[model samples]
Target chain A: MAHIHLGEGSFPLWALVLWTLLGVGLISAVVYRVRKGGIKTHQIALAGIAAAASFAIFQLNIPVWGGIHMNLTGLVGILAGPLLGALIALVVNIFSAALGHGAVGLLGANTLVNASEAIVAYYAFKTLIGMDWDVFPASASAATLGLSAGAFLMGAIIVVSGVNGSALPRGDLTIAVAGLVGLNLFAAFLAAGYWGFTVTGGAMPWAKRSAKALQRGVQEGGGALVELGRGIVVAGPIRKGGLMVEFGALVLVLGVLGIGLYVYVDRYGGFEDGERPAR
Target chain B: MTVTTLSNHVPDPRLVTAFAEQRDGPLHRVNPWTKIGIVGALVLAVTVFDRLALLAGLYGAVLVVYGLAGLPYRRLAGWYTLPLLFIVSVAGPLTFLEPGTPIGGTLPTPLGELSVTWAGIVLFAELSCRSLTVVTFALTASMTTKYTDVAYMLGRLLPRPIDQIALLTYRFTFVMLETLEDLVKAALSRGANFSEFWSNKRLYARILGMTMLSAIEQSERLVKSMEARGYNGDITLYGDVSRPPIHELFVVIGSYVAVVGYAAVAVYGVRQ
Candidate 1:
């Protein structure tokens, strides 16, 4: 979901080298750990299958956000251990790059983005499970958190590497990336929130009741904002609705923040006509 | 879109493998290592050269080589869609953002005045060339090189379990893809509609979850079968890639030297 789709030469040579070296370092450590620990055969099989599934699903576009594919790196991390999950990330990226889905030059950067997702998701899922959380909530939350981490990491990578030939200053680029990452996080949260709401069977009833109350309040000359605030604070019969409300507020905030950053970059990002930054 | 339709748009591993195995062109006979080395050189060259003419020339040369290799030009053009989309998305904003002599008069936008500059157009073209050059060559290499050679190369290049996993994954991706296709078909036949994401989020999640569960079970069965065959953990590929010939080696070296020399001159202003 957070894959960097930039083609070759999008990053400068130094940034490319830096990311490639970091990527190599990561894979080297993973390899060393696997060699020292000696993986079980069953785990190897699982990793192999997980990689296949992840790669296949990476291309499978679901009807979301006008056709987007899910990474499933989170699920890969949970199913295959982190060590193997990280390896799977490398494998998937290699295959994808080979097939021209991603740039061969950005393999290192892309690998880092994806491997982090799997690693974070694995640990997050484990931690949540350890905390006695239900499987659905724990997995969903962990996946969302993991994907969010990937999105932020991707943003950082683009900001640090800096797009070649882009006229935007580092500051403006950071703002643009922040906006993009914010939007990505918003989508992740919205999907996770909706998934949670539907699975828990608490959102529909509460949402319907809230809608009626909101309409009544508006008809009675009360503002929709007042009704929304009331709905948030009321804490109705469905306790899970609180989680949805929290998710709703978060999604709204992220959406606003993302759009605001885009607007900010558009208006004041130093792209004024006929004015070039002093190189 | 349904999985079946969407699958058509994606680069099919099967088609890639078919091209690699069936094509008996000059490139097909070349050593995988040589092709891989050339790919590396191309990457370096594209990374170093920023001039629009040089980039376009490089892209033109790559396309000629691709054509010479007996690869399908039509399919190659088709495959350009993703890279093109990526280039536009990243560089699209730059066209308006880069300051230069505006090609068209600035238009009033909600955020500010917007105009495409000559410099911005040049930037976009350069980026597009850089992206497509690598993408085209990468596809050329993959299509020309057989999957067994690829698996063998991975086995030699990567470490123990990583190599093993990659090899297995490459083979099983087809199986999993088939399974996924079947699942999608079954869902569609059972009146499952995936046209809307928000409304069908549950169905999407369920289909994905089912695929995961099936993969887990498939892996369990695979483990038992492999264990029965005395497989301990190592997966060995019998196929091997021959070392690059001396001339090919020189060509590869010459390409690298050319890139290094170009970079020194282009970037550092080093005199020949």
Candidate 2:
């Protein structure tokens, strides 16, 4: 089979072209929106949210205690506007590509997959918000719809691109699906919580407090390990700082976790391709 | 494609001008769209299949383009040589995995499951050629087209929403960079050199945290100002210009012809 390897998966040329065009179209629209003041501040905030979501999706995963792991760019998009979210996913995908997560050619498709979540989220939120419900209730309801819709969109895109059915074997599909679900839920919850907190208090209390504590903890010079840990903690919640740190952390975690999954899947998961499974 | 070894400090302006030359005498008068079409067609023709032929065409075409563009010097010498690096990075390991004829003695690798092959080398060369061709065409397009013209062309090609975004992004790129710089400077004044803060995670966090806070505030102000002016989902273009030039037709035709001819010849050669 001719597989074009990218950030983490293989895709066909059609997917690449389709996704690139979509990204171009979406990003262009967002730019127009920014210029025209169709919620410009929201767009930048959405961009930040998307970046954060990309980081959360890629970096922070707890071992499911099984062979499966998680990733979550879609959930982030749900909170951010589709266009803005897609743009953020593109930025993250590009950054990831630089680090060899996928092939450079696959940047477009990867961005498209991640952005689908944000787009779905935007519509979902719009629909829920029009209900005129209270902010918290609306946010929660919207988040659920956004997350599920985002996952469904991802699944649909994957299936259409032949990624789920043919690109990956039946066994790997389960792992990927499971990972996607976990990532979506986690991202949606975090995004909702952040959105809720931001609207109510102008800041996330937990993240803010965590940032303060982390700063205090790292006031004195420490060992390399301590410093690294401290960097992660302090960097994890300072808005933009957290986003970059979180992204880097996610890439490292995913890489290590991906390798682990490959080994476990090879031994127990039983890859159908017969060739060495992609990490 | 010709890697001009830069011994001198300054780039040779004449070579760059020569390299940037478009479709010769008559084509010079052609429309930008036609020029774009020709370049696009040529690039597409070479890229579809067979990296070797693509590379060869790219090398030849780029050399001619470069000569015409008057660019004989490479700005970033290392970047231009990246094709070779990519080939080695991919092909070096692939050779061992393929299990082909061991032309000579064994070479050591970090991985125990692989060995080298002549096939791998050929594959590497082919891949290198593809990359080189892409770089050449990209460079040619960039050299020949102005940023504004490219933006204008892209705007015309895309939907109204997207086209407007391209123009906005292009216009705002410098503004964003300037904003980023000022923010960075402010951070620096407050004992925040991000490079030094690497040893201190808290400091790193503080810098980014503070920067984002300020960025958000500034963006909010900017957004408010724009909204106050009754900005909506549309941006006004500087002038009403959308007509294609008469000479552009020839340029577009020539481009398609060259691309189609190259692709046809290469495909035929490959099949035979």
Give the runs in model 2 whose Cα sits over 4 Å from its true position: A1-79, A87-110, A113-279, B1-32, B51-54, B70-72, B78-92, B107-113, B183-215, B240-248, B261-272
Candidate with the greatest TM-score versus the true structure: 1
User: How badly does each model clash, as a count of residue pairs?
Assistant: 0, 34
Q: What C-alpha lDDT does candidate 1 achieve relative to the native structure?
A: 0.74
Residue A162, model 2, lDDT: 35
lDDT of 2 at A29: 40
Interface RMSD of each: 6.7, 11.6
Alpha-carbon shift of residue A130 in model 2 (angstroms): 20
Please write out the lDDT profile of model 1 over residues A1-279, one tens digit for every residue: 577757898887767776786787667656654654456677788788878888777667776645666657876766665667678889898888888888888998999898888767766766776678755576678778878888899988898777876667777677666767887788777765447445533243233332232122123210111123336421112233434454455446544654565455446644364443222
lDDT of each: 0.74, 0.43
Ten-residue region with minimum lDDT total, candidate 2 chain A: A218-227
Candidate 1 error regions (>4 Å): A196-279, B1-6, B109-111
Model 2 TM-score (2 dp): 0.50
How many clashes in candidate 2? 34
Q: Against the true structure, what is each candidate's TM-score? A: 0.82, 0.50
